[model samples]
Target: MPTGLALRDPRQQLFDAAERVLVRDGPTGLTSRAVTTEAGVAKGVLHRYFADFDAFLTGLVLDRIARVKAQATALGETAGTGTVADNLTSALMTSFDPVMVSIVALIIARDELRTRLRTAGTARFPLVGEGSAMIAGYLTAERELGRIAPDADIDTVAPTLIGAAHLLFTERKDSPPEPEAVRKVVTTVLAGAMR
Candidate 1:
């Protein structure tokens, strides 16, 4: 019998390395060589796992989306355990991390990669849409717990918060917003909805 979990997933390791390269060097620096070097694997490792660089890029974006979605789900799980502002701020911060920002930049700058992502059935890259839904779900749970106004329009509030945070993260590419700034945005967006 194997002791603990002996087998490791190479794909996850590669994805982590790719993320490091992306955060440190931006989209332009995310070549196969760079990814492999960062991962401590041969250049052929990525190609073996993915069809090509475009495939790898798409996989990375999708992986990140899934991760954010999982986090959103967890937020719903603990709806009433923490302050609404704190919870919202944590969710927004996770979405706007440096690696995620770099991936967004990569998708925008590389037309080929974008085409590949579209072909993968993410034409609009529904990260924001999915995130909005998660936020709405969390808000609904909070409202049920008497944490928010009974009449709060959750649908509208969710998108407003997501859109503002997305814009703030994208616009401030060089200087990511501070925690206070994110908190301010969260507070502002939640004012009408929160009790």
Candidate 2:
């Protein structure tokens, strides 16, 4: 594939390198040297794309946030025939990537950076919001089909379901929760809450 000077924006290179380093070695491995080496760029090149370490870190978080939101938004926008659990499952599952979790952890730890990110509006991509919206959509469909309870308030319920998913995905252990365990938590919560 065509890359390097063929790519006009060096920022994309930094982002791509950041993604790889983050997935492979987690957030602590995201150094300018590491990213530059991964991108095959001179160490100084990282500065041209990013103002500093903090800026690059902010961008890293924002990039993952955008991806998660995009995934949830696309799933929400799609017109699919399935049970409420299925649609909710699709959106909730996307939130499990290590990339997003690592970003969230860094943002939470760096209050100054997190503050700048919030003020810069990089922290408001609505990742969880998108998942909630997807759940709301599914619940609406279920209600229309009389499969979900008429009294159910999707706006409230969706976030509750997403919150559970967040906790399950955030588990830090030598052995992370299995896919089946995560699915069970999501499905059980949705089943009880939907109808």
Candidate 3:
């Protein structure tokens, strides 16, 4: 008799496999059978956990959003304890993965993932609002410390700054910007907006 593969819980195995496949191959590669094979489970395991390919895709997108939110959460919790520039820099830097950013930008450029995100409504996703708020929180701390002007509207400035950073860094595949240069953009816009 042939030896069998070691068994693990189906749902855990599916999610773990899906995560690996997504990280390595991204959205288009997340097929049910592929995930099951990666986990050494039967093909039917994916269907048992997720209703369909669409359902699995949705879960994967949401999981990615949750991970970004967790990073933003950690940044938010630490925002007040550091220098304003340092805190904001840390928060923005966490979201800028050159490889994944390029992949997502290409996917959106082809109108593949963008259509889904539009239909899903970007605001409903945790990462957007959570990231914006985290930035705003840091700006507010800056204002309190008089590092920014007294009349800064953190609510508007924060989202605008985050949007600008995302636009510049997340959608391009040219030579990447330097860390110090990126930090300058953050500090300059933040100061200008506050001033």
Candidate 4:
């Protein structure tokens, strides 16, 4: 164990290291050993903090969910402030950034991890589900502000927009799409809803 690790937040260190492993090696490559090694902490450190590898993964996924929720809150507050497409474009980039997109891939690849997340009552599909909800909330607020069609079905629009954004982002996992590319998808998906 590094003497310095005791002074820092081990859980956060592990989570960040796990994130790097997932992005670098993909989900199949995410092992307890990999995380500990990447973190430069002793293997025992992970076990000491978490019950098992599943527990550690659960903690990491939950931490990511919380981050998405924070982004959602920030986006929700922006209702009516900017063009709807512009707000959604920015939110999509933050919501589906590289790490987040990798986390989504991880959730899809690991049945055990997905089961653990569901058992813990994290969002149904984690990032994707939460991302949809985030867009839904923002679209709802815009509807109330009369920036969108009064009859716009925000529920449908939200998921459609998120799904489209997710596709665009995942298409090139090495780099995020240009903001203009995201904005194009946002505008296309929300065309029916926007005023």
Candidate 5:
């Protein structure tokens, strides 16, 4: 059966296949062959798009980072539209999703991949930092609308929320945190900060 991936942009198809391999088989299971097989493309297809496996891995990480950043950037558009906690939970969900967690774990565990990423000038994935800044910006906007306490330390609150979400997602390996739990985390964090 044709996977139809061959019809998509080769790079994106390879990226999607890499993600599926990473999620289902973990980092050790990810290989050029694996991605090509999953993508249902010729084994040589990935090599044609990327220099090597490391390059592909770095590209995948960077692409995911870009997506996270975009999500964070769009979060500001939700300002004042819903309960602060609800809005925040929705935004943070992307960071803690199963795919993201697997990617983070893979990047951290592989020295070669990490070195390649760092050499590419992305030593650290900036998703958390960027997300914190975006959240802080959103909080500031909310404060202007009187939704948050005027004296709330948005800088601190933003990183705190990110950290809490990271912990919740990373620690609960067997059973992912539920949406309500995510909401609760956001609510508890904002209780003193929101008006």
Candidate 6:
């Protein structure tokens, strides 16, 4: 960008650019220079907004966590209204979508970023942990409504679903797994839980 040029929302611009770099290059290709270049801003701009690259990454993952929390609220609203399998499938598809899957990979690859995230007060593995919470919350609501067995261990089931969805998305690479594939995993995982 031109020197002294103004951006309406530099943070969001940088974030969106970071996501694009992550998608195209995977974790190895992500760097402060890459993000700034992708954002069309000076490298100094990133430092201005964040303490370091890890801080910037923390911002990105935390932003995503907020999105997952919002998704959780929306998923909670659907608890008793849809088939449990269908609701879970929908949640998995959106919760672990392409960008999110990549973000998870990015998080796993950066030790410093992980430490920084913890320092920033997000000790959980951001995307995966938050996504699991979303699933668990929905399942808990379902159980309360008698849609699922009262004995269902949602804490275990939630992370299992997130892991399976992450695997499907990661292995598929070129495309997202079909809804049927996700549905099958959901139904299978929850078979003992669904009443």
Off by over 4 Å in 3: 1-30, 33-41, 98-126, 141-147, 171-177, 193-195
Q: lDDT tens digits, residues 1-195, model 6?
A: 565989899999999999999999999998999999999999999999999888899999999888999999999999889698998899888887778988999999999888877777773886788888899999999999999899999989999988888888899888898999999999999988988
Models 1 onward score TM values of: 0.83, 0.75, 0.67, 0.95, 0.84, 0.96
Error of 1 at 129 (Å): 2.9
Q: Per model, state how many residue pairs clash.
A: 0, 0, 0, 0, 0, 0
Model 3 error, position 94 (Å): 1.3
Arrange candidates by TM-score, descending.
6, 4, 5, 1, 2, 3
RMSD of each: 4.7, 3.9, 4.5, 1.3, 3.0, 1.1
lDDT of 1 by residue, 74-100 (tens): 989979987999999988887778777
Off by over 4 Å in 1: 1-7, 118-123, 170-176
Candidate 4, residue 141: the lDDT equals 87
Q: Show where candidate 5 strays beyond 4 Å.
A: 1-6, 115-123, 173-175
In candidate 3, what are the lDDT values of residues 1-195, reduced to their tens digit? 122555567666677787677656665675677787787777766787778766665555556566666776676566447666676776677676553353343344435444565577554433455567767766666577666788877888888877777776755545556667668878787776544
The 0-to-1 C-alpha lDDT of every candidate, in the order given, reads 0.83, 0.67, 0.64, 0.88, 0.82, 0.89
By lDDT, the better pick of 4 and 5 is 4
Best of the candidates, TM-score: 6
Task: Give lDDT for model 3.
Answer: 0.64
Error in Å for residue 83 of model 6:
1.1
- Runs of candidate 4 exceeding 4 Å displacement: 1-5
Q: Give the TM-score of candidate 1.
A: 0.83
TM-score between candidate 4 and the true structure: 0.95
TM-score: model 2 vs. ground truth = 0.75
